[model samples]
Target: MSSTPTTFDVRADFPILSQTVHGTPLVYLDSGATSQKPQVVLDAEVDFLTRANSAVHRGAHTLAGEATELFEDARATVSGFLGARPEQLVWTSGATFALNLVAYAIGNATAGRGPSRFALAPGDEIVVTETEHHANLIPWQELAARTGAVLRSIPVRDDGTLDTDAAASLIGERTRVVAFTHVSNVLGIVNPVAELVALARTAGALTVLDACQSAPHLPFDFDALGVDLAAFSGHKMLGPYGVGGLLGRSDVLDDLPPFLTGGSMVTTVTLDEAHFLAAPQKFEAGTQPVSQAIGLAAAARYLEGLGMDAVHDRERTLERRMMAGLREIEGVRILGDASGVERVGIASFDVEGVHAHDVGQFLDDRGVAVRVGHHCAKPLHARFGLTASVRASTSVFTTDDEIDVFLDALAGVRPFFGVGA
Candidate 1:
């Protein structure tokens, strides 16, 4: 495979894209919600289940060994994809669980069982941005409430960019943890992660990132970013559902307590207490998502083979085209700063004189799939005086024709609703 896979080749690998919706060809533009999977990812999961099906790390049998090897190899593959070590990744159900693990572990530590380095006390603060998904926002909010720590947020500027100057001011010595999204799931704008991380470091605060919107689209080196921890989901990255990971600095994972405990995570168990395994294993309990992990590894490999620089460049062109198309449609106001800021291929907007749901149904009728509603970032929508908006996101498999179809469908929405000029 070359550094850049052609769009036709990429689209061919995804079987579902060949289908039709309401008698029109399916023009999928909702990659931000969850990406459609490729044949290789699907094949990987089935191959694992059919041949090497067994409990990982528990049995001494041959099948168990094969399963364990495949599972661990997947870990190594995914870790390498993120510029991390296998020891630094912990498997979870998805990004939501990954974020919860960090928050819950901090809460548990503050209750006096885990490391003091993670414990939060009164007057200590946790900072996040206004544009965070509820997955990132609520967990930290609950953590602060549980630990008596105050929660602070860096407000978003009018253009949908984060107010980094305000973040620098709010993240003082009292701030214990600083969490933010690498890209806004709603606004489609990229945040200044390095700047925010530097601010948090200057205040001696730990940093966490929600990378669910980034890992599949960009080449990520977590260690290079200088964050203490980050989480992302596999399903959003052309991988299977029900599996994701928490990638952290080894020192931080060593200090944090296990969020879940049961079989396989233990080294020794007395009648009263148990000794847990090392960092990655200590955090993974019960039967693991073996097939999902293997599939996700394949997805990572598929992305790497295509090369992230090429993926980013293709998506940048698509985003510019989509943005320009949206601007031509009167009353279709984009939700964020419509300037020369950087963003992924996510375009979210509100059409005047039409409810988001109505616009969404109109699009669906025309076989154009777009994400509607708050997108789990209600606070971000509330900032724009909107209860909801429509989002059309792109991926490596997205085509120019699909984008044009979406724009055409959007242009017809108002006229169909009898609200045209």
Candidate 2:
């Protein structure tokens, strides 16, 4: 409560917060799923559709030219936002697609194209974390399945932080690739990427980072963190859906082969063979999500204007407030380190007597929207002896009042269900 941010009333910017969900004003606590769009972002999309709508990097028409310029500008915006050069960023459908591209691209390299830097032999290892969202886990699983490689994971402690001791023992000479989330989507635990990356580097392995949760909540410098490649989605950061970024080291990308091939990504295409475009252009494949990219860039600009530090500060305040509120409730056991350094506001808790789904229903009836169930990290839930938990996440646009509404509704859920006092 002491750290609650009062300088800015972020609730004013999201118009939808004014409406009723089930007889009460909507208290959206689901930014971890997809953040609510601000007026600036909405207008960016509208303006693109209204004033400048056309294919990019292909058409010579005025609209096409304008759209292309805006789209690339967005690319530049996102690239700069991530502390990467413009050429380092490749647009994708979402973070999942971005991640899938990496796994598949490296698989192609192993098959023979360029240096074959990622060939997964029978004994090679692909390392991941137990808390990874399926997006980061399944691609590697499929890659390992395709190759004869074995998939290994770093264990999570009871507090939800990565088990560095286990990581040191697991990452060995045969470990060819290391991939983990910068921040866990379900637990809100921020992985110690710097320490982990150092471990990966020492093992001479390639590193991939899932920054889906980190990018929106805090500023990130991929280079400083020493990750070989990273991915993040726009929807989680108040940008249009279907727009995400994959950032990889320029040299590393040059070695990995393309996953998807078609128009616009080629330098030359013959009837029997084709030469590829440079790094990012080579990866962009088809006509890109032009408008979505433009909106996403606008979102980047908006976040930058507000200052990433400010955004981080606000979110930290909210996290503490939320943690304090959850701790005050009876029968609510929070599932994370709670050490403050390795955590954020995306909190999940198990109610002693009520089922997670039932709790969700009760919250919904009272107009408090919270995510319930496994939350796409089934393995992490399994590790914690849980099938599901109630999750409430916050964003910069979330206000203290909305959280209060959610807590008030949450407190009433058990009594309404007749499960607990």
lDDT of 1 by residue, 1-421 (tens): 2345335358889999999999999999999999999999999999999999999998899999999999999999999999899999999999999999999999989999898988999989999999999999999989988888999999998889888789888999899999999999988888899999898889889999999999998879999999999999999999999999999999999989988999989999999999999999999999899999999999999999988877887888788889999999978999894587888999899999999999999999989999999999999889899999999999998899888999988998888888856
Clashes of each: 1, 0
Residue-level lDDT of model 2, residues 1-421, one tens digit each, is 2254534566677777788977877888988988998888889999999998898987689998998899889999999998999889999999999999999988887787656567778889999999999999999999999888999999998888889999999998999999999999988988889888889999999999999999998878877888999999999988999999899999987777888999989989889999999889888888799889989988898888878877887777778778888888888888874575656669998988999999998898888888999999999999988999999998887887777888877877777767665
lDDT of each: 0.92, 0.88
Indicate which candidate wins on TM-score.
Answer: 1
Model 1 bad stretches (over 4 Å): 1-8
Best by lDDT: 1
In angstroms, give how far residue 218 of model 2 lies from its true place.
0.6
* Residue pairs that clash (backbone atoms under 3 angstroms), model 1: 159-337
State every prediction's TM-score relative to the real structure: 0.98, 0.97
**Which regions of candidate 2 fall more than 4 Å away from where they truly are?**
1-6
